[model samples]
Target: MTDCGCDKAKAELVEYLHNELARDDASDIREHMAGCADCSSEFHVNVVMTETVQRACRETAPEELRVQVLARLRDLQASHG
Candidate 1:
């Protein structure tokens, strides 16, 4: 096993994808991915899925719908709080 275990690397994957991980943590995930085919495949799939959704959202989001959604979220949050 590498210094960074696959479980730890995968656990931090969301942070890595969001560009929120520290440099050292990101490096550990990279090192693990370099050596683990299964983990790498999963990570790649997550990357592709995230990118596709983001691109689609950027290109096709309805502005009015977005406003409505934000308003609804704010209302919901206010109610909960």
Candidate 2:
């Protein structure tokens, strides 16, 4: 991620790009991205990653891989509990 001028603003921009911000706060972040080059580039990278994940999700994931992951998660949860 490009280091924007302010840490807080950069964090807000990340949340905004990920659609994790509240409606009222997101508008301000959107405006900041429009005016900031660093923020704009960071947002563009996030957009690309999001699109890549969405496209990848269309392909089938291995069932055995999913089962192994779930089994590990259950084991971890049980150990923690």
Candidate 3:
């Protein structure tokens, strides 16, 4: 496997992190990261950021906030419709 240089690897890091790249492209990024410390470090940061965003998305709003938002939406619907 050829080392896809840092430019391509960095450019595709997000797609690689989210499994959005085609198989061969992903493999190329992985191979590049294996040998390039800079790309690897950037990939690690992206991984942590992706995990953090995923975790944040999983969190539910407070019950009071949910109710308030729903109430506001209902009021707007009633006013508009």
Best by lDDT: 3
RMSD for all candidates, in order, please: 6.0, 6.9, 2.4
Tens-digit lDDT track for model 3 on 26-51? 99999999999999999999999989
TM-score (C-alpha) between model 1 and the true structure = 0.66
Stretches off by above 4 angstroms in model 1 are 61-81
Error of 1 at 33 (Å): 0.5
Model 1, position 72, has a per-residue lDDT of 100
- Model 2 TM-score is 0.58
* Residue 3 Cα positional deviation in candidate 3, in Å, after optimal superposition: 1.2
Write the residue-wise lDDT of candidate 2 on 29-60 in tens digits: 66667788777788788889988988998998
Candidate 1 pairs with clashing backbones: none
Which has the better lDDT: candidate 1, or candidate 2?
Answer: 1
Candidate 1: how many backbone clashes? 0
* Residues forming the 10-long window of minimal summed lDDT in candidate 1: 1-10
What lDDT score is found at residue 21 in candidate 1? 92
Q: After superposition, how far is residue 59 of candidate 1 from its true place, in Å?
A: 3.1
